[model samples]
Target: MKRKKTLNMMSEEDFLFTFQHGDYKFVFEYDTPDEFREYLSELKDTVKELEAEKSYKRVQQIFKKEEQIEGEIKKGERPANKENFTFYDLETKFIVGKKKLEKVSASTYKAYEATFTKLKDFFKYERIENLNIEDFERFRDYLSTQVVNKTVNNHMAYVKMFVKWGNDRKLYPENNVQGVENLADSSPEIPHVNYTDKEIRNILEFEEFEQCYKDTFLIATRTGMRVNEICNIKNDDIKQDEETNIYYFDIKKSKTNAGVRQVPIHKDILERVLEIDFPLFPEKTDNASQKAILRQLYRVVKQGEGKFFHTFRGTFMNRCLKNYPRDLPIIQEIVGHEKEDKIKLSVDTYAKGYQLSLKKEILDSVSYY
Candidate 1:
């Protein structure tokens, strides 16, 4: 037989080479120096083959996962095929919801975002079906430690909304979101009082308000307009009747469809609007209204947390509800409260929108005077 050349490949010269990449480290040694060159060449080729195999497997996994996602979506079903359904997917759903919704305020949207973030962090991205009420309880318990009971309630309500929103679309099964009950009302213990005419005038003339937010605040106090509603107002939203010479703001964005009605501007605020020349509040952000405008207003008036931009809204409603002719439903329409019966459907849908003259009359009933 010819000499066999397949030497059992242990070299005696002890050549050692180290390889390192990221968190992995390795060393290889050859005991035979004369044979090291050929052995090292073979080792390099083997390592390259193993690395190529690993990369191919990874690419295959990515493609397979994408195909699975596409199939689930086409079937109009949640991606339950995956081992872990992502909370990232759920957050995407939340954003879709915010966009589909009409006239959601910036502040409310921020709350939704924050609430979802906390849910994701606490649960660490659980699959929709794998999630249960106990998981919600864990999140709730965690929030209770981190926030006050009132803030906790606000967050929990949005959490329930998230789960309910998903449940409605079959993203989560029914009753999976039920156990997160709201904590008791922990609103600041202050007597609810309507913003008085005296207080309203005091803040309007209070000088500091003059420098930044006099017009918008005056509009809120008079019209009971929410800050978000006013901040988003555009020049086109301000309208006049060629016939009546009446001026009003058509509120296209609000808490409800009832909020889509118009408010005839009072002379005081309208004069200020005329002078400013464009969208009344230059500051567009929600914090500009809440933290910047209202924060200063709150301090100037010595008002507590109980008194806010919304309190002025209550005051407008209080004055109108207490004084305006309730049988006409004028105040209700102006303040954007839903009509209880279909008997008044004409007022809601007639002539481009609610009759401008009628709304003007209702708005005239509400003023800083």
Candidate 2:
């Protein structure tokens, strides 16, 4: 038997051995000959176990476990002893810490909360330390069954974040989730469907649609705001520009800095909004309001398979581009899109954006009738 082969001898006491078994390769380091012999004995035992099990996954787990133990020993930290600690326990602590710290926005925090809820449901009572790459693969399989590939990727991203958080805190071994990868989002990429003027009219005039849904859809189409931004509008958010006396939506709090802008209300919806006093939709959760809008939209529009509440935004942009193709900067400002082109970037750096009156003109021009 090839008993001991030293690949690199850094010193008389230090030894680094590169060992390869079939398709698997591992590097082991020891401070002394005695330690090297001890590790060799452990390696032999692992080989015997692998031979008995003949499972490639078990082989990975065993080697990864050894590496984790070695890593902890090198760092002068005790190896993770989380036999009683569970995925639920770590997730609870992580979520509570996130909430207490207020590190993320409410919407983002809600997404994290939802992801962890699914993780808890799937991984119930599973030990955090025992979770290896295979377990995460299993979790991904479970997520695929529950949601579309796109949503599964989102959940997997959150899971990866959670595992990384645990590793950073030394709560678990880093190798536990080392090989997990998100499933490919093979779902067909549906092109953004811009609602035509006729389709828009049908949705707004449908007698079955609730008044709030109509208002929400109208606001979205007119202002080009995201569903969350539209739902978050308040009475105070409606402001009149002092210089031009142009009334606009003062979107102060937004998901992005570019989203925080004065979106001039279109002339078509202005009078109706003023009649109802600013907040067009009734006070309700953003998610609920968004769902209501979608439900109403689907009921009225026959060609709404890929279309959503956000499609109204696409329609707004399409109309703007159709009318003012040269004034891309103004359109981008109105829709709260970041100026990415060199010309737009230069304009953003030097200019405070188009005047509210100019924005109003552009928005008023976007007519469905």
Candidate 3:
């Protein structure tokens, strides 16, 4: 029979009650009928709630703990450590933080990051600390086996940067890894300047590309814009002076703030700009669009077969050299260039006040030359 409070007031002395279960005990005291009943109900609920809470806490504690292997291996049971690690694994972390590891451009960091994967494969079994000058030299020699001097030089530079970063961070303390020297001494062939009048026609008439090339070429040749500078052009960048018949483009200096200068728009390019209905890049018309229109140009142009858009810039510069005042400061403004040199002077001379007139002159020269 379950125990309860006294049946009468005569038996009012408090009695202790104890209950036992596996790994748990409960004890309480009660004197009155109401007190004993309420205490009994409360104790039951408390015990169940505590058990549920303990189970929940145990589950949460397991998830918070890091996993550790506990099983006995038949033959390969050993604690995992850095002893057997490859150089490539450590290099990954370094490359991700490579820019922060050393202040470098995104493209430079990306190029450096690619070298680590190749290095990892080259030094597959060797640990990072075990690498020395010989290992890197051997890898360099392997790279030299297939690539040309320029390509080899590019890879060598990236690897050297990696080594410099590793050394600075003391990643490989045991090994004093002096990076391999560039062995290839051959200079790359410098192609002769062939910016002829006829070449300009070929570049302009080469319609086997996209509207981007056409638009960009028009801007580059007529306005003498740099590759990246032209690429960065926005619709909002154009500023016009109808009364003076002069057009200006608000531009940021790509090379330096000092390089910033107002460009006078050529009339031919101005007309072309007016003709285009929508954003220059239709698919992603937004300013932050990543698509390079050049790559898709071939599909757009129905006439010409194999011409690149950049050749227009070359033609434009050559035209500038031929027509404008070669030593004019206007050349720097037109070309969006930082350094003023002989080439710029030549361009300035040929392309002075390069507007619709100059563009027509270039086309006529191309036609007649």
Candidate 2 clashing pairs?
none
Error of 1 at 182 (Å): 2.9
With candidate 3 superimposed using the best TM-score fit, by how many Å does residue 163's alpha carbon deviate from the native? 2.7
lDDT tens digits by residue: candidate 1, 1-369 = 121232334343335777665455656775456566766686678778778888999999978966765554544343543345456666665565566655566677787788878887887766767878787777787998998888888888877777777677766556466767877766657766777788888888777555447777777877878777777788888888788888888787778888887688876667776556446556456655567776777766676646777788778878776666563466777777777666356665553446677666666677665
Where model 3 places Cα greater than 4 Å from the true spot, the runs are 1-110, 124-130, 165-179, 185-192, 240-246, 253-261, 275-279, 282-315, 321-330, 340-369
Scored against the true structure, residue 252 in model 3 reaches a CA lDDT of: 58
- Candidate 2: tens digits of C-alpha lDDT, residues 28-114: 888668998999999999888777777877888978965764554344333443545666666555765575554456667788888
Please list the residue runs of candidate 1 whose C-alpha ends up more than 4 Å from where it truly belongs after superposition: 1-83, 185-189, 343-346, 349-354, 367-369
- TM-score order of candidates, best first? 1, 2, 3
Whichever of 1 and 2 has more TM-score, that candidate is: 1
lDDT of each: 0.70, 0.76, 0.56
Local distance difference test, candidate 2: 0.76
Clashes of each: 7, 0, 14
Per-residue lDDT value at 290 in model 2: 68
Clashes of 3: 14
